[model samples]
Target chain A: MIPFEHIMILSAAIFLLGLIGLFVRKDALTLLVCMGLLIMAVGVLWIAVAKSFGEMLGQGVVLAIIATAFVQGCVGVMLILKLQVHKPSLQVKQFTELKG
Target chain B: MRVELFYLIAILCLFFSLGAVFSTKVVTSLFCFLGCVLTVTLLFVLLQASAIAVIYMLLFCLLVSIYWVTAIVFLPKPNKNAYSKHFLHVGVFLLLGGWLLFVLLPFLQVPAFSPAEIDHGFGSARHLVNVLFGPLRHLWYALLALILAFLISVPVLIRDNTKCGDLS
Candidate 1:
Protein backbone atom coordinates (compact mmCIF):
# COMPACT_ATOMS: atom_id res chain seq x y z
CA MET A 1 0.00 0.00 0.00
CA ILE A 2 1.21 3.46 -0.90
CA PRO A 3 1.04 5.68 2.10
CA PHE A 4 -0.49 9.15 1.95
CA GLU A 5 2.81 10.86 2.70
CA HIS A 6 4.46 9.26 -0.28
CA ILE A 7 1.74 10.63 -2.49
CA MET A 8 2.14 13.97 -0.74
CA ILE A 9 5.80 13.93 -1.62
CA LEU A 10 4.98 13.09 -5.21
CA SER A 11 2.51 15.92 -5.54
CA ALA A 12 4.87 18.36 -3.89
CA ALA A 13 7.66 17.36 -6.20
CA ILE A 14 5.44 17.88 -9.19
CA PHE A 15 4.31 21.22 -7.84
CA LEU A 16 7.89 22.33 -7.32
CA LEU A 17 8.79 21.28 -10.82
CA GLY A 18 5.86 23.17 -12.26
CA LEU A 19 6.63 26.24 -10.17
CA ILE A 20 10.22 26.18 -11.35
CA GLY A 21 9.08 25.96 -14.94
CA LEU A 22 6.62 28.74 -14.32
CA PHE A 23 9.38 31.02 -13.05
CA VAL A 24 12.17 29.95 -15.36
CA ARG A 25 10.58 29.46 -18.78
CA LYS A 26 10.26 32.63 -20.82
CA ASP A 27 8.14 30.99 -23.52
CA ALA A 28 4.38 31.44 -23.21
CA LEU A 29 3.40 27.93 -24.21
CA THR A 30 5.83 26.40 -21.75
CA LEU A 31 4.42 28.70 -19.14
CA LEU A 32 0.96 27.41 -19.98
CA VAL A 33 2.15 23.85 -19.66
CA CYS A 34 3.79 24.58 -16.34
CA MET A 35 0.63 26.24 -15.11
CA GLY A 36 -1.32 23.17 -16.14
CA LEU A 37 1.12 21.01 -14.24
CA LEU A 38 0.71 23.19 -11.19
CA ILE A 39 -3.05 22.82 -11.37
CA MET A 40 -2.73 19.11 -11.92
CA ALA A 41 -0.52 18.84 -8.88
CA VAL A 42 -3.32 20.39 -6.86
CA GLY A 43 -5.71 17.90 -8.36
CA VAL A 44 -3.34 15.14 -7.36
CA LEU A 45 -3.39 16.29 -3.79
CA TRP A 46 -7.17 16.52 -3.84
CA ILE A 47 -7.48 13.00 -5.10
CA ALA A 48 -4.99 11.72 -2.59
CA VAL A 49 -6.72 13.35 0.33
CA ALA A 50 -10.09 12.20 -0.90
CA LYS A 51 -8.83 8.66 -1.14
CA SER A 52 -7.35 8.75 2.31
CA PHE A 53 -10.59 10.03 3.74
CA GLY A 54 -12.83 7.96 1.49
CA GLU A 55 -14.72 10.90 0.01
CA MET A 56 -15.86 11.49 -3.56
CA LEU A 57 -16.01 15.26 -3.63
CA GLY A 58 -12.44 15.61 -4.81
CA GLN A 59 -13.15 13.86 -8.09
CA GLY A 60 -16.03 16.20 -8.79
CA VAL A 61 -13.85 19.20 -8.06
CA VAL A 62 -11.17 17.83 -10.33
CA LEU A 63 -13.70 17.26 -13.09
CA ALA A 64 -14.77 20.89 -12.97
CA ILE A 65 -11.13 21.92 -12.94
CA ILE A 66 -10.42 19.84 -16.02
CA ALA A 67 -13.32 21.48 -17.83
CA THR A 68 -12.08 24.94 -16.92
CA ALA A 69 -8.55 24.05 -17.99
CA PHE A 70 -9.81 22.77 -21.33
CA VAL A 71 -11.41 26.10 -22.14
CA GLN A 72 -8.45 27.92 -20.66
CA GLY A 73 -6.08 26.08 -22.96
CA CYS A 74 -8.21 26.90 -25.97
CA VAL A 75 -8.29 30.59 -25.10
CA GLY A 76 -4.64 30.62 -24.15
CA VAL A 77 -3.66 29.00 -27.44
CA MET A 78 -5.73 31.55 -29.34
CA LEU A 79 -4.04 34.40 -27.51
CA ILE A 80 -0.69 32.85 -28.21
CA LEU A 81 -1.66 32.57 -31.86
CA LYS A 82 -2.71 36.18 -31.91
CA LEU A 83 0.57 37.14 -30.31
CA GLN A 84 2.34 35.10 -32.90
CA VAL A 85 0.45 36.93 -35.62
CA HIS A 86 1.41 40.31 -34.20
CA LYS A 87 5.04 39.47 -33.44
CA PRO A 88 7.16 36.58 -34.62
CA SER A 89 8.41 35.94 -31.12
CA LEU A 90 7.09 34.31 -27.89
CA GLN A 91 9.44 36.02 -25.49
CA VAL A 92 7.77 37.09 -22.25
CA LYS A 93 9.88 40.21 -22.14
CA GLN A 94 8.33 41.60 -25.33
CA PHE A 95 4.68 41.41 -24.23
CA THR A 96 4.84 44.29 -21.74
CA GLU A 97 2.26 46.25 -23.68
CA LEU A 98 -1.44 45.46 -24.29
CA LYS A 99 -1.23 46.67 -27.89
CA GLY A 100 -0.90 45.10 -31.26
CA MET B 1 -2.51 1.72 -4.50
CA ARG B 2 0.08 -0.89 -5.37
CA VAL B 3 3.46 0.31 -4.18
CA GLU B 4 5.62 -0.90 -7.02
CA LEU B 5 3.33 0.41 -9.72
CA PHE B 6 2.77 3.69 -7.91
CA TYR B 7 6.46 4.39 -7.50
CA LEU B 8 7.16 3.46 -11.08
CA ILE B 9 4.51 5.83 -12.41
CA ALA B 10 5.57 8.57 -10.03
CA ILE B 11 9.22 8.29 -10.96
CA LEU B 12 8.47 8.23 -14.64
CA CYS B 13 6.17 11.20 -14.33
CA LEU B 14 8.83 13.18 -12.52
CA PHE B 15 11.41 12.38 -15.15
CA PHE B 16 9.06 13.36 -17.95
CA SER B 17 8.25 16.66 -16.25
CA LEU B 18 11.95 17.36 -15.93
CA GLY B 19 12.49 16.55 -19.57
CA ALA B 20 9.69 18.84 -20.59
CA VAL B 21 11.20 21.67 -18.58
CA PHE B 22 14.78 21.20 -19.78
CA SER B 23 14.53 20.02 -23.37
CA THR B 24 15.96 22.31 -26.05
CA LYS B 25 13.56 21.68 -28.88
CA VAL B 26 9.99 22.96 -28.61
CA VAL B 27 8.61 19.76 -30.04
CA THR B 28 10.75 17.73 -27.67
CA SER B 29 9.47 19.59 -24.64
CA LEU B 30 5.90 19.25 -25.88
CA PHE B 31 6.31 15.54 -26.39
CA CYS B 32 7.84 15.20 -22.95
CA PHE B 33 4.80 17.02 -21.65
CA LEU B 34 2.64 14.51 -23.48
CA GLY B 35 4.40 11.70 -21.69
CA CYS B 36 4.11 13.56 -18.41
CA VAL B 37 0.39 14.02 -18.97
CA LEU B 38 -0.07 10.36 -19.70
CA THR B 39 1.77 9.39 -16.53
CA VAL B 40 -0.41 11.77 -14.59
CA THR B 41 -3.42 10.09 -16.13
CA LEU B 42 -2.09 6.83 -14.75
CA LEU B 43 -1.77 8.43 -11.36
CA PHE B 44 -5.41 9.46 -11.72
CA VAL B 45 -6.41 5.91 -12.47
CA LEU B 46 -4.30 4.60 -9.61
CA LEU B 47 -6.11 6.98 -7.34
CA GLN B 48 -9.39 5.53 -8.54
CA ALA B 49 -11.17 8.27 -10.48
CA SER B 50 -14.58 7.47 -11.94
CA ALA B 51 -15.00 6.26 -15.52
CA ILE B 52 -16.43 9.64 -16.46
CA ALA B 53 -13.36 11.32 -15.06
CA VAL B 54 -11.21 9.03 -17.16
CA ILE B 55 -13.20 10.10 -20.22
CA TYR B 56 -12.57 13.73 -19.25
CA MET B 57 -8.86 12.97 -19.03
CA LEU B 58 -8.87 11.48 -22.52
CA LEU B 59 -10.34 14.77 -23.69
CA PHE B 60 -7.51 16.54 -21.93
CA CYS B 61 -5.09 14.37 -23.89
CA LEU B 62 -6.89 15.29 -27.09
CA LEU B 63 -6.51 18.95 -26.23
CA VAL B 64 -2.79 18.48 -25.69
CA SER B 65 -2.38 16.70 -29.02
CA ILE B 66 -4.09 19.66 -30.67
CA TYR B 67 -1.60 21.90 -28.95
CA TRP B 68 1.16 19.75 -30.35
CA VAL B 69 -0.17 20.15 -33.89
CA THR B 70 -0.61 23.88 -33.46
CA ALA B 71 2.87 24.28 -32.06
CA ILE B 72 4.40 22.24 -34.83
CA VAL B 73 2.62 24.16 -37.53
CA PHE B 74 2.19 27.75 -36.35
CA LEU B 75 4.59 28.83 -33.61
CA PRO B 76 7.89 30.49 -34.50
CA LYS B 77 11.27 28.91 -34.06
CA PRO B 78 13.18 32.00 -32.96
CA ASN B 79 11.69 31.76 -29.46
CA LYS B 80 13.95 28.86 -28.54
CA ASN B 81 16.31 31.27 -26.86
CA ALA B 82 13.54 32.19 -24.44
CA TYR B 83 14.21 29.11 -22.30
CA SER B 84 16.25 30.33 -19.35
CA LYS B 85 19.27 28.19 -18.53
CA HIS B 86 20.58 30.55 -15.88
CA PHE B 87 21.59 28.89 -12.58
CA LEU B 88 20.55 31.99 -10.66
CA HIS B 89 16.97 31.61 -11.84
CA VAL B 90 17.04 27.91 -11.07
CA GLY B 91 18.55 28.40 -7.63
CA VAL B 92 16.00 31.01 -6.69
CA PHE B 93 13.21 28.75 -7.83
CA LEU B 94 14.63 25.94 -5.75
CA LEU B 95 14.65 28.23 -2.75
CA LEU B 96 10.99 28.97 -3.38
CA GLY B 97 10.25 25.28 -3.38
CA GLY B 98 12.23 24.78 -0.18
CA TRP B 99 10.36 27.57 1.54
CA LEU B 100 7.03 26.07 0.56
CA LEU B 101 8.19 22.71 1.80
CA PHE B 102 9.27 24.21 5.09
CA VAL B 103 5.87 25.78 5.47
CA LEU B 104 4.01 22.62 4.59
CA LEU B 105 6.18 20.15 6.47
CA PRO B 106 3.83 19.89 9.40
CA PHE B 107 0.94 18.62 7.31
CA LEU B 108 2.90 16.00 5.38
CA GLN B 109 2.40 13.15 7.78
CA VAL B 110 1.25 9.78 6.50
CA PRO B 111 -2.13 9.34 8.11
CA ALA B 112 -2.85 5.88 9.46
CA PHE B 113 -5.14 3.87 7.22
CA SER B 114 -5.05 0.34 5.88
CA PRO B 115 -4.71 0.02 2.11
CA ALA B 116 -8.21 -1.36 1.86
CA GLU B 117 -9.76 1.62 3.63
CA ILE B 118 -7.97 3.90 1.24
CA ASP B 119 -9.44 1.91 -1.64
CA HIS B 120 -12.99 2.36 -0.39
CA GLY B 121 -14.91 3.74 -3.35
CA PHE B 122 -14.27 7.46 -3.21
CA GLY B 123 -14.28 8.91 -6.73
CA SER B 124 -17.44 7.81 -8.53
CA ALA B 125 -19.62 9.92 -10.89
CA ARG B 126 -22.62 9.86 -8.60
CA HIS B 127 -20.62 11.49 -5.85
CA LEU B 128 -19.39 13.95 -8.42
CA VAL B 129 -22.95 15.08 -9.06
CA ASN B 130 -23.62 15.32 -5.37
CA VAL B 131 -20.53 17.43 -4.99
CA LEU B 132 -21.37 19.80 -7.86
CA PHE B 133 -25.13 20.01 -7.24
CA GLY B 134 -25.57 19.01 -3.61
CA PRO B 135 -24.81 21.52 -0.89
CA LEU B 136 -24.45 25.15 -1.88
CA ARG B 137 -26.24 24.21 -5.05
CA HIS B 138 -27.22 27.82 -5.62
CA LEU B 139 -23.62 28.93 -5.40
CA TRP B 140 -22.59 26.20 -7.78
CA TYR B 141 -25.23 27.30 -10.28
CA ALA B 142 -24.15 30.91 -9.95
CA LEU B 143 -20.55 30.02 -10.57
CA LEU B 144 -21.57 27.91 -13.54
CA ALA B 145 -23.60 30.78 -14.95
CA LEU B 146 -20.69 33.15 -14.55
CA ILE B 147 -18.39 30.75 -16.32
CA LEU B 148 -20.93 30.31 -19.08
CA ALA B 149 -21.24 34.05 -19.52
CA PHE B 150 -17.50 34.40 -19.72
CA LEU B 151 -17.27 31.67 -22.32
CA ILE B 152 -20.08 33.17 -24.40
CA SER B 153 -18.67 36.68 -24.25
CA VAL B 154 -15.13 35.81 -25.32
CA PRO B 155 -15.74 35.25 -29.04
CA VAL B 156 -17.75 38.45 -29.30
CA LEU B 157 -15.04 40.32 -27.49
CA ILE B 158 -12.44 38.93 -29.82
CA ARG B 159 -14.51 39.84 -32.85
CA ASP B 160 -14.87 43.43 -31.64
CA ASN B 161 -11.20 43.64 -30.83
CA THR B 162 -10.25 42.45 -34.28
CA LYS B 163 -12.78 44.75 -35.93
CA CYS B 164 -11.30 47.69 -34.07
CA GLY B 165 -7.81 46.51 -35.15
CA ASP B 166 -6.61 46.37 -31.54
CA LEU B 167 -5.28 42.91 -30.85
CA SER B 168 -5.07 43.61 -27.14
Candidate 2:
Protein backbone atom coordinates (compact mmCIF):
# COMPACT_ATOMS: atom_id res chain seq x y z
CA MET A 1 0.00 0.00 0.00
CA ILE A 2 1.13 3.51 -0.69
CA PRO A 3 1.94 5.83 2.15
CA PHE A 4 -0.69 8.35 3.13
CA GLU A 5 1.76 11.19 2.95
CA HIS A 6 2.52 10.46 -0.66
CA ILE A 7 -1.15 10.31 -1.49
CA MET A 8 -1.71 13.59 0.32
CA ILE A 9 1.09 15.23 -1.63
CA LEU A 10 -0.26 13.94 -4.90
CA SER A 11 -3.76 15.12 -4.15
CA ALA A 12 -2.44 18.49 -3.06
CA ALA A 13 -0.57 18.82 -6.31
CA ILE A 14 -3.68 18.00 -8.28
CA PHE A 15 -5.67 20.42 -6.16
CA LEU A 16 -3.16 23.16 -6.86
CA LEU A 17 -3.31 22.39 -10.55
CA GLY A 18 -7.05 22.82 -10.42
CA LEU A 19 -6.70 26.06 -8.50
CA ILE A 20 -4.30 27.42 -11.08
CA GLY A 21 -6.57 26.28 -13.88
CA LEU A 22 -9.48 27.99 -12.23
CA PHE A 23 -7.60 31.29 -12.28
CA VAL A 24 -5.81 30.88 -15.59
CA ARG A 25 -8.64 29.62 -17.74
CA LYS A 26 -10.88 32.16 -19.38
CA ASP A 27 -13.87 29.99 -20.28
CA ALA A 28 -16.75 29.19 -17.99
CA LEU A 29 -16.66 25.54 -19.07
CA THR A 30 -12.98 25.33 -18.18
CA LEU A 31 -13.67 26.91 -14.82
CA LEU A 32 -16.32 24.29 -14.13
CA VAL A 33 -13.91 21.60 -15.19
CA CYS A 34 -11.33 22.96 -12.78
CA MET A 35 -13.93 22.87 -10.05
CA GLY A 36 -14.49 19.21 -10.81
CA LEU A 37 -10.79 18.60 -10.51
CA LEU A 38 -10.74 20.39 -7.19
CA ILE A 39 -13.61 18.24 -5.98
CA MET A 40 -11.81 15.10 -7.08
CA ALA A 41 -8.69 16.14 -5.24
CA VAL A 42 -10.64 16.59 -2.04
CA GLY A 43 -12.28 13.20 -2.52
CA VAL A 44 -8.93 11.57 -3.00
CA LEU A 45 -7.59 13.17 0.14
CA TRP A 46 -10.59 12.03 2.12
CA ILE A 47 -10.26 8.48 0.89
CA ALA A 48 -6.57 8.36 1.60
CA VAL A 49 -6.92 9.55 5.15
CA ALA A 50 -9.85 7.27 5.78
CA LYS A 51 -8.02 4.29 4.41
CA SER A 52 -5.11 5.03 6.65
CA PHE A 53 -7.45 5.07 9.60
CA GLY A 54 -9.24 1.89 8.52
CA GLU A 55 -12.57 3.63 8.55
CA MET A 56 -15.49 3.32 6.13
CA LEU A 57 -16.89 6.78 6.66
CA GLY A 58 -14.54 8.37 4.18
CA GLN A 59 -15.71 6.03 1.45
CA GLY A 60 -19.28 6.95 2.21
CA VAL A 61 -18.46 10.64 2.03
CA VAL A 62 -16.59 10.14 -1.20
CA LEU A 63 -19.62 8.40 -2.64
CA ALA A 64 -21.81 11.31 -1.62
CA ILE A 65 -19.31 13.74 -3.11
CA ILE A 66 -19.35 11.82 -6.37
CA ALA A 67 -23.12 12.07 -6.58
CA THR A 68 -23.02 15.74 -5.70
CA ALA A 69 -20.33 16.35 -8.29
CA PHE A 70 -22.38 14.67 -10.96
CA VAL A 71 -25.35 16.87 -10.22
CA GLN A 72 -23.20 19.98 -10.03
CA GLY A 73 -21.51 19.16 -13.32
CA CYS A 74 -24.81 18.76 -15.10
CA VAL A 75 -26.30 21.93 -13.64
CA GLY A 76 -23.13 23.87 -14.33
CA VAL A 77 -23.13 22.73 -17.92
CA MET A 78 -26.75 23.72 -18.31
CA LEU A 79 -26.10 27.18 -16.93
CA ILE A 80 -23.06 27.62 -19.15
CA LEU A 81 -25.09 26.53 -22.13
CA LYS A 82 -27.78 29.01 -21.27
CA LEU A 83 -25.21 31.77 -20.97
CA GLN A 84 -23.69 30.73 -24.27
CA VAL A 85 -27.10 30.83 -25.89
CA HIS A 86 -27.57 34.37 -24.71
CA LYS A 87 -24.13 35.76 -25.50
CA PRO A 88 -22.85 33.19 -27.97
CA SER A 89 -19.66 33.00 -25.93
CA LEU A 90 -18.29 30.97 -23.02
CA GLN A 91 -15.60 33.46 -22.07
CA VAL A 92 -15.71 34.33 -18.37
CA LYS A 93 -14.93 37.97 -19.03
CA GLN A 94 -18.18 38.35 -20.94
CA PHE A 95 -20.32 37.83 -17.86
CA THR A 96 -18.74 40.36 -15.50
CA GLU A 97 -21.57 42.90 -15.72
CA LEU A 98 -23.92 41.26 -13.19
CA LYS A 99 -23.43 43.75 -10.34
CA GLY A 100 -27.14 44.35 -9.98
CA MET B 1 6.52 -2.68 -5.81
CA ARG B 2 3.16 -1.20 -4.87
CA VAL B 3 4.80 2.07 -3.96
CA GLU B 4 6.49 2.25 -7.37
CA LEU B 5 3.17 1.52 -9.04
CA PHE B 6 1.54 4.22 -6.95
CA TYR B 7 4.20 6.70 -7.95
CA LEU B 8 3.72 5.83 -11.61
CA ILE B 9 -0.01 6.28 -11.38
CA ALA B 10 0.34 9.48 -9.44
CA ILE B 11 2.75 10.89 -12.00
CA LEU B 12 0.41 9.93 -14.81
CA CYS B 13 -2.51 11.59 -13.05
CA LEU B 14 -0.51 14.77 -12.50
CA PHE B 15 0.67 14.90 -16.10
CA PHE B 16 -2.76 14.34 -17.58
CA SER B 17 -4.36 16.82 -15.21
CA LEU B 18 -1.82 19.43 -16.27
CA GLY B 19 -2.73 18.64 -19.85
CA ALA B 20 -6.37 18.96 -19.00
CA VAL B 21 -5.74 22.37 -17.55
CA PHE B 22 -3.38 23.73 -20.19
CA SER B 23 -4.48 22.17 -23.46
CA THR B 24 -5.51 24.69 -26.08
CA LYS B 25 -8.71 23.11 -27.33
CA VAL B 26 -11.68 22.35 -25.13
CA VAL B 27 -12.08 18.85 -26.55
CA THR B 28 -8.44 18.12 -26.00
CA SER B 29 -8.63 19.42 -22.48
CA LEU B 30 -11.72 17.35 -21.80
CA PHE B 31 -10.06 14.23 -23.09
CA CYS B 32 -7.06 14.95 -20.92
CA PHE B 33 -9.38 15.44 -17.97
CA LEU B 34 -10.88 12.06 -18.70
CA GLY B 35 -7.42 10.60 -18.74
CA CYS B 36 -6.70 12.24 -15.39
CA VAL B 37 -9.86 10.81 -13.91
CA LEU B 38 -9.00 7.37 -15.22
CA THR B 39 -5.59 7.53 -13.63
CA VAL B 40 -7.04 8.70 -10.35
CA THR B 41 -9.51 5.84 -10.42
CA LEU B 42 -6.63 3.45 -10.86
CA LEU B 43 -4.88 5.09 -7.92
CA PHE B 44 -7.99 4.63 -5.82
CA VAL B 45 -8.05 0.97 -6.70
CA LEU B 46 -4.42 0.71 -5.67
CA LEU B 47 -5.29 2.35 -2.39
CA GLN B 48 -7.96 -0.33 -1.80
CA ALA B 49 -10.95 1.91 -2.32
CA SER B 50 -12.42 -0.19 -5.08
CA ALA B 51 -15.93 1.11 -4.49
CA ILE B 52 -14.82 4.71 -4.78
CA ALA B 53 -12.81 3.75 -7.85
CA VAL B 54 -15.87 2.21 -9.45
CA ILE B 55 -18.06 5.16 -8.51
CA TYR B 56 -15.54 7.58 -9.98
CA MET B 57 -15.31 5.49 -13.13
CA LEU B 58 -19.06 5.60 -13.51
CA LEU B 59 -19.67 9.20 -12.54
CA PHE B 60 -16.60 11.01 -13.84
CA CYS B 61 -15.47 8.83 -16.69
CA LEU B 62 -18.87 7.83 -18.02
CA LEU B 63 -21.46 10.34 -16.87
CA VAL B 64 -19.54 13.57 -16.57
CA SER B 65 -17.48 13.03 -19.70
CA ILE B 66 -20.59 12.28 -21.72
CA TYR B 67 -22.28 15.37 -20.39
CA TRP B 68 -19.25 17.50 -21.18
CA VAL B 69 -18.94 16.08 -24.68
CA THR B 70 -22.57 16.78 -25.41
CA ALA B 71 -22.23 20.29 -24.07
CA ILE B 72 -19.14 20.84 -26.19
CA VAL B 73 -20.90 19.53 -29.24
CA PHE B 74 -23.60 22.17 -28.85
CA LEU B 75 -21.20 24.96 -27.90
CA PRO B 76 -19.82 27.22 -30.57
CA LYS B 77 -16.21 26.45 -31.40
CA PRO B 78 -14.11 28.05 -28.72
CA ASN B 79 -11.81 30.94 -29.54
CA LYS B 80 -8.28 29.69 -30.08
CA ASN B 81 -6.78 32.73 -28.40
CA ALA B 82 -8.84 32.51 -25.25
CA TYR B 83 -5.93 31.70 -22.91
CA SER B 84 -4.75 34.28 -20.42
CA LYS B 85 -1.56 36.17 -21.21
CA HIS B 86 -0.09 35.67 -17.73
CA PHE B 87 0.60 31.95 -18.02
CA LEU B 88 4.15 32.11 -16.70
CA HIS B 89 3.23 34.32 -13.80
CA VAL B 90 0.31 32.16 -12.81
CA GLY B 91 2.33 28.98 -13.11
CA VAL B 92 5.11 30.35 -10.92
CA PHE B 93 2.71 31.59 -8.30
CA LEU B 94 0.91 28.27 -8.15
CA LEU B 95 4.17 26.41 -7.84
CA LEU B 96 5.19 28.59 -4.93
CA GLY B 97 1.81 28.15 -3.31
CA GLY B 98 1.95 24.39 -3.67
CA TRP B 99 5.44 24.27 -2.24
CA LEU B 100 4.36 26.29 0.75
CA LEU B 101 1.43 23.97 1.35
CA PHE B 102 3.66 20.93 1.09
CA VAL B 103 6.11 22.36 3.55
CA LEU B 104 3.54 23.44 6.08
CA LEU B 105 1.12 20.53 6.03
CA PRO B 106 3.41 18.01 7.73
CA PHE B 107 3.24 20.08 10.89
CA LEU B 108 -0.43 19.22 11.23
CA GLN B 109 0.55 15.68 12.35
CA VAL B 110 -1.77 13.93 9.95
CA PRO B 111 -1.47 10.19 10.43
CA ALA B 112 0.95 8.28 8.29
CA PHE B 113 0.05 5.05 6.58
CA SER B 114 0.26 2.07 8.93
CA PRO B 115 -1.51 -0.63 7.04
CA ALA B 116 -4.36 -2.06 9.02
CA GLU B 117 -5.41 -5.68 8.67
CA ILE B 118 -7.51 -5.81 5.54
CA ASP B 119 -11.18 -6.31 6.19
CA HIS B 120 -12.58 -8.32 3.35
CA GLY B 121 -15.73 -6.23 3.37
CA PHE B 122 -14.08 -2.88 3.81
CA GLY B 123 -15.21 -1.14 0.66
CA SER B 124 -18.08 -3.40 -0.21
CA ALA B 125 -21.53 -2.04 -0.98
CA ARG B 126 -22.90 -3.58 2.17
CA HIS B 127 -20.31 -1.80 4.24
CA LEU B 128 -21.05 1.47 2.55
CA VAL B 129 -24.77 1.03 3.11
CA ASN B 130 -24.32 0.21 6.75
CA VAL B 131 -22.09 3.19 7.32
CA LEU B 132 -24.40 5.52 5.50
CA PHE B 133 -27.48 4.33 7.27
CA GLY B 134 -25.93 3.62 10.63
CA PRO B 135 -23.92 6.47 12.08
CA LEU B 136 -24.10 8.86 9.13
CA ARG B 137 -27.81 8.52 8.47
CA HIS B 138 -28.56 12.16 9.14
CA LEU B 139 -25.90 13.25 6.66
CA TRP B 140 -27.31 10.90 4.07
CA TYR B 141 -30.78 12.32 4.49
CA ALA B 142 -29.48 15.86 4.29
CA LEU B 143 -27.57 15.11 1.13
CA LEU B 144 -30.58 13.45 -0.43
CA ALA B 145 -32.77 16.41 0.41
CA LEU B 146 -30.22 18.80 -1.00
CA ILE B 147 -30.06 16.85 -4.23
CA LEU B 148 -33.82 16.74 -4.50
CA ALA B 149 -34.07 20.47 -3.84
CA PHE B 150 -31.49 21.26 -6.48
CA LEU B 151 -33.21 19.03 -9.01
CA ILE B 152 -36.62 20.49 -8.33
CA SER B 153 -35.59 24.12 -8.20
CA VAL B 154 -33.37 24.33 -11.26
CA PRO B 155 -36.10 24.09 -13.86
CA VAL B 156 -38.31 26.56 -12.03
CA LEU B 157 -35.44 28.98 -11.66
CA ILE B 158 -34.55 28.67 -15.31
CA ARG B 159 -38.13 29.14 -16.38
CA ASP B 160 -38.51 32.22 -14.23
CA ASN B 161 -35.30 33.67 -15.57
CA THR B 162 -36.43 33.09 -19.11
CA LYS B 163 -39.83 34.60 -18.44
CA CYS B 164 -38.20 37.64 -16.88
CA GLY B 165 -35.94 38.00 -19.96
CA ASP B 166 -32.91 37.54 -17.76
CA LEU B 167 -31.71 34.29 -19.32
CA SER B 168 -32.64 34.80 -22.96
Q: Highest DockQ: which candidate? A: 2
**Candidate 2 chain A worst ten-residue window by lDDT:** A81-90
Q: Write the per-residue lDDT of candidate 2 for residues A9-62, one digit (tens) a residue.
A: 999999999999998999776777788899989999998988899998888879
Sort candidate 1 into its docking category. acceptable
Candidate with maximal lDDT: 2
lDDT minimum window of 10 residues, candidate 1 chain A:
A84-93
> Which ranges in model 1 have alpha carbons more than 4 Å from their true place?
B75-121, B130-168
Candidate 1, position B107, lDDT = 50
Which candidate number has the best TM-score? Answer: 2
Q: Name the runs in model 2 displaced over 4 angstroms.
A: B74-120, B138-168
lDDT of each: 0.70, 0.73
lDDT: worst 10-residue window of model 1 chain B: B109-118
